[model samples]
Target chain A: MSRLPPLVPGFVAAGLVVGIIGASLGALFVVGSGADGSILGDPYVRRIVVFTLWQAGLSAVLAVGLAIPVARALARRRFPGRTALLHLFGLPLVLPVIVAVFGIVLVFGGHGWINQALDRLSLGPLGSLYGLQGILLAHVFFNLPLAVRALLLALATVPGESWRLAAQLGMAPAQVFRFVEWPVLRQALPGIATLVFFLCFTSFAAVLTLGGGPAATVLEVAIYQALRLDFDLGRAGSLAIAQLAICGLVAAGLLGLGRSVAVTPELGRATARPDVRRGVGALGDGLAIAIAAALVALPLAALVARGLTGPLSTVLRDPAIWSAAGRSLAVGVSAAALALAVACGLAVATRELRLTYRVRHLATAPDMVAALPLATSVLALGAGLFALLHRVVAVFDVALILVAGINALFVLPYAMRLIAPRMLHVAEAYGPLCASLGISGWNRLRLVEWPSLRAPVGLALALGAALAAGDLGAVALFGTQDTATLPLLLYQRMASYRMEEAAVIALLLMAIAGALFIVLERGIGGREHP
Target chain B: MSTLDLQAVGFRYEDMTMTFTLRVPAGGITALIGPSGAGKTTLLNLIAGFERPVSGRVLIDGVDMAGRAPADRPVTMLFQEHNLFPHLTAADNVGLGIHPGLRLAAPERARVDEALDEIGLAGLGRRLPGQLSGGERQRVALARSLVRRRPILLLDEPFAALGPGLRRDMLALVDRLRRAQGLTVLMVSHDPGDARRIAERTAFVHSGHILAEGPTADVLGPGATPEVADYLGEHV
Candidate 1:
């Protein structure tokens, strides 16, 4: 009897992922068990924990609360550049966290645009843009757009028939919202809230920069401090465990909610919302959309303006900045390559189980492996790996490798999401035809699958590269003075109050990410449709 | 050409346990007609080695086809849609039949052109599937199947997506190919008119069983079985 080869590549990759995660967790437990409880009981540690929960909860509430009107306005209106505005909302997700924060500082800081405007008006300038308010502002800036996109998706799912009925019945704006939109929006609310909370809970670069001092520290920054600032492995280990436990619980809740945050919103359905055409309601929607657009656009605008205006020629000549940029480029390309390989294997295995073997439940096993880094925070994973490797090798020697590897795993879920749907479609549509035609293995991949899969695979690679290029999470834990990436270099500049140089670096990093996205997507993807 | 036989071949799909037994004499067109979800397609899949039966055996020319993969089996099939890869040109898609890699020597390349000529698609081999009409796409698939030259050809409603006039033209083309190549044809179709047009033998498949079998005139005539009449009634 002829037998298909055991899905060796896919299974081996999956097993390796599981083994790495298992070893990381095992090392964490071992180190954590040896640690004393004194660190957990410290007043500063307790404050950090409380502040972490407070900030995440407040961020989730504020982001979602503000997103409702914006999403509603977008749902009802059909203006020019509406699609462009929605696309702009997707920028915060791929934009480097530190760059956005630097932009926030430029716009809202003491000597920033707002304060300058206040000074010119002879109204006293605001006192500060630090502490809780600054942290909240940055968090909301990142997450409000995310919330708006998610809510926009929910609003799009409101069947067109409901809108038609509302118009026929002459339902008022408030009545249409209550009768038609509320039910669908409420159902989608919890999942978006949980996702936003989880993101804010594990936030690293944003809080690390805007968090003025210890009073506003989150657990991720605390882990960095405990590990790097004090050289206290015990404290770091315990804090890492604590953060993992909380994040795991939140992630479990997210899974129970049965929604993965969508990175790209589906094409918005054009429902004819005729209830609020040109009354006060129309004016209100326009205002809501205008404010949300400015909120998302201003920081990015400030980043570009400051970047072009500040020491561009000198920063371009600095060798340290160039070396850091080179290191970041290396890490990003390596991470993208590794991530695409693993995502392909997992996607192939998943299609085999789902289509050929017909075991729907078992197909999700590979997906679970891909999603492992999500449940376990990236910093925790890094600290655990550091502990595991410290006894055998110098951690500094393998910093780039560790950072790239973890970032690959960190981006694996997104890569898989992008590739798996298209890969399965290619297999399902052509499997039997290929089978009857004696097309299998390399022939099938080259002739049948490659033509259909290249576009999505290129997109996956591009996104992975951009996300990894600007990553500061795992690199912060593993980086030394000699091994600093661009984001790390930018962070150091910010910490030491070299605001001018930092702006230049932030702009450079942003440009690198954008260029990587375009190059990989276009160079590999070939064309939009093909 | 080959004689195809199913000897009490059994399959379990979800809660349904289907057992089918049938035979088609060599070098003739045999059509299996039934209501939707009546195991007609499953029967074709079993014979083409696309599906494995739970019990008994499928024999081609009296040899048990049990341990052969679909590719190794002496059969070819054309699905309802996606018969050609969207990216591949017509010539390359047909060339796959001669050698899976399209590594054609002079004579092998000539065979692809000849098959395309037979299917009336000559000189259009450079066009991709997206550039072809619905009828042209199915003809291209027929051309590929002709080049494969398998003794048995299974058509799983290959022309169902076409309009009536186009479907009949495709059926006439299949009839000509079958006669010219001396191929055994087992076709699954929903329309009884498909059987009336070219199929000499017809089998009524119902509830995973061959409910009736005979000449097409006798089976589909006015004095048919009650179940067959009822099924035909629904279509009308």
Candidate 2:
């Protein structure tokens, strides 16, 4: 059986990505006049860039800084539901962006639950839901759980032998962290922090909704504002270029994170982590878990609580809501299918590339290809696509397709995370067998590869779908009255002070997002084989 | 008589360099006995076409198999473990030897069944590799090699994981297969007793060089090289 050379898929993936991001930025450069000093000369653009960096920086620092204690607590403690707690912390991964933002709003809004509590306690109602605080709150809300889980994984990876040694030496808790924990965390922290930073920096839908006004704008919002509201294509192009430069720099910085901490393979031979239960440490860990749990759970509770208001029948009967939900389902399914195809191709191709090239750097190439697009804000992607397609077809007419394409690209890194490692493992284990047995090409895929990859491949598709279902970035730029997705419709309803409809739609979007995730992750995908 | 030859073959992995010039007479069994990390496995890999030698020819029956893929080589190898896909049943794994597609004709299927039954795994063809005992697993692997109908077989410690009694049985099976098929066999083992049991000739590989190659009794006889004498210890 013959197959194409391994580099073909990666090159195709890289090409499509370059064509999209490159054409977006290049066309902007071509069409727009030299607005070289736009970030400095234009006061509005200057404010937006500063705020974008300021919020992402603050969010990254807070997410990681706070996650350290929470993650350590989870790692060291063997409390009941510890596993469930870690899974809960991953909720934001499947929850759509708008649903998360809605949850945040319901908790932090002026008339929301937290403000009501403050008023009852005679602490002045904190109207923190509409500006810089709102943006940072949502960012932290989304990223803190992820940061904690990542850090916990980092903490657990500190070889069991090291823990036994620390215990045998009777090292104090602080000393244990300093000598043992800190080194592992230090290795993993940069990647997690930089990832969180890039995500917040490319903030779109959440920023679009919570930005309050021009006073708290980000570069992404500015691009959308220029293109959609002002119809200033030149200004939008300049802003898109500016955003890419800043994001590209951050993405490059992210590539430097310490990686692949070799798991000391001596298993069953090493003793279990020196069973720890000191009084002071136990008390402190309990406190950390309590605080983190409350911080993560309250907003989700608020989303459900705030949504049960307004006549339930009227809320469900709204035809626009049903239509928006239908559109979202279609878009999510289509994007997931598209993203899975792309992710599988790139992963398999990368496996081939690694085999043919036999270089360590090329092994990490697929990850970089997947991640580079992540740093390119979808708003900028939207602006570029709009410019290119506006030349041939009307921008609004192809809005759904454009949004699906962007969301697919946006969800790609996550899909690759599920796919690439397992693909490489399969290639390593079976490459010789395949070579020896004359199993190659489509037959190899059908007989050998598919049986192994089905689970992770299914998981990747599900995650892709969930992310697409909840996308607000591209939808906000191109969404029209005729073709508005649930997220866009939810945002529009919130903008018009139809809080009743907004709440209902918020719950609906969350349910849909959560349902797709559960169905695909649990129902479709089988247990991952080692 | 078919011959298996390695003509000045050389391979380098990391810091270790291995060179070989060897010949195996048709139907003779050569035991490659070495300490661990002595490149015995690497030599087998080269001959099986899993890896290419840096220099010279791997000539099987007067044909230089320089550019042949592993599947194209007239050799079959059984690794120490993982010789069969865990997902495939014993029959299916054996069927892969005859046709990798595992889409055997009715007669070919009967042949696979017969091979299994001959290996004393008649009713176990439906069992996955994981379900089989260590000795049974290697029997399945050996049976697969038998179905391949290759003239030369390279077995790298195929029964190393089996117990002493089971190891003897597996070696007997190899001997039976070799005599019946007139197969030229090269088997790597750390145990000198294994060479005494089945091999006609024994080759001692130590740190990238072959220390001795002769009839097993002569090589392990009193006049053996000091290094070989020292290594074989009591097992010889």
Candidate 3:
């Protein structure tokens, strides 16, 4: 009887994740069930719940609605920096959220660039940048690029043959969109929309900083408030469960929308789109591209300009700022290492279980486990761990570790998405050769796995570091005076109306996150060495 | 080299149950020609210990190969592509045959050098697979197989990606190596001409069964069975 290769490491890693998430959820249920009344009975709680759905729904609708034209324009046109623009779209995903929000405030605030232009034109100043509109602007600023990238990936899947057929028949622009593009768009639209909506729904830092009052409060922030401000464990637990259910539904909607759209290998081949060359349509495409680019770029430009012109000397003199930066660095690096290790374990096990053992169900289990954080909100996990660990161990003592662990889970899905497929591809291609040559264990890893996995693993680590460094959710829940990282520090400055100080901190945060991203990507994920 | 025998080997792929039985002579070339998905590669995989037989023994020189791993069997195989690691230098790839770690002693290193010389890639061992031409990459893979010093060599259309002239040259190189080392070779080919060029014996595989087996000229000639004739219709 032939025995299967040991899959213990992957399963053990996956089990640890399951135990962490499952125990957290169990704690939330226990605390929530003990509450005296329905958490939704209070009008304020109901309003917060309703507003959470309202903002997320509107944000997703607006982002995805705007992304369609922008994606089409991008797909049809080719120009200089086109590839750079696509890479820029990837930035918003890993870019620090608080930094971008500062950028939004600088560009769209009452005394900012756009209002200054409006006032110069004899138009009155637009009102405050601290309400529902502020939240929507920030959400779209972050998600529009994301939606465009996703849709562009979808558009890339349109076969060169289909484009050739369309060109041969001389299909007009409208006919081409209707016949060829719309079907692909229709399939990808739901998945992108759900992703955007889920992101906005669970957003904490943007909503907290810009929420202004109870009118703009989201469940994520409300849970934070119930735990930290009100010291009401019951309300926090109830809010965590509500957020979990809604996120679970959104995740299910995403999975239900998943259909395996067949992609031919002849992707990225130079297929000139028939209806989009040197015409009025080309002019419109250029216009769409410009507007989308401006929407993404202006804020970042304003951020750097405002930050460079802020109170540089005073902010630099502050010891708290430097310390916070150090702590953020520590958390970022540790989180990245942990995230990559867990993701690799899950990916290797998933590949081996599927290909070697032929255990289909177990192969997919690690992926599901890796995706747990998407359904279980980071704030929910934070609240549960707080409830479970507060009495036994001082949560404040191990605050950095908690934040890093939770952040690893937060970014686990992206890590798995980026790493698993590449690993599987390497396995499928070289597995038989390696097996025939007795290249197992460390020999296989060093000679075979590392060479192929370096790029994706570097990407995962860089993204994980940047995202974790900029994260404000778990840190907000656990951050005491000593544990405040750069994002938390920036939030504190912004709250106290220290706009100039916030500007410098924002710039510093962006620099730190950007440096980590570049260093990890370049240092570890070096150019595919020949 | 040793004799290879498949004694009523049975495998179920999806809804199809395939049964194969063939005796490949020692130190000789046996070519498997069939329609696509007609179990040509499967037969080679069974002999290489990559797939297990459900109902019969794969006897390599009268020793049952059941439960033996692919590496434990005295076999080497080359696929159409990915025969050489794209990232490794030609010499390092060949040296993997000597030690999976590529930690070779001086004599083993000399053996790698000698194998590369035999395959006409003598001084090109430091180049990565990306730097080598398609035919040269196959030559590198052939060198690795030579250094492995395995008794059985299975080729799953290893030269299918090359042009006709390159393919002919590679076949001649294989014939030379087979003659020098006395290695038993079982090669699968879609092109009957590949078998006619150098294979001493040819087997016509049709719908999961060996329909015809004999000297290469007769099996690939007008005397073939109807299924074989249909499969080889235009080529023959």
DockQ, each predicted model = 0.01, 0.01, 0.01
For model 1, the docking class works out as incorrect
What is candidate 2's DockQ?
0.01
Candidate 2 lDDT over A21-68, as tens digits, reads: 778777777655555554457887778888899999999999889889
Q: Write the per-residue lDDT of candidate 1 for residues A391-462, one digit (tens) a residue.
A: 999998999999899889988888888888888898889989999999988899899988888888887888
Candidate 2 chain B lowest-lDDT run of ten: B95-104
Clashing pairs in 2: none
DockQ of 1: 0.01
For candidate 2, what is the DockQ-based docking class? incorrect
Question: What is the lDDT for A502 in model 1?
Answer: 87
lDDT of 2 by residue, B103-174 (tens): 679999999999999889999999988899888888998887788788888888988888888898888888
Q: For every candidate, give the share of true A-B contacts it also has.
A: 0.00, 0.00, 0.00
Distance from true location, Cα of B41 in model 3, Å: 33
Q: Which stretches of candidate 3 lie over 4 Å from their true place?
A: A1-5, A258-269, B1-236
lDDT of 1 at A274: 45
Greater lDDT among 1 and 2 belongs to 1
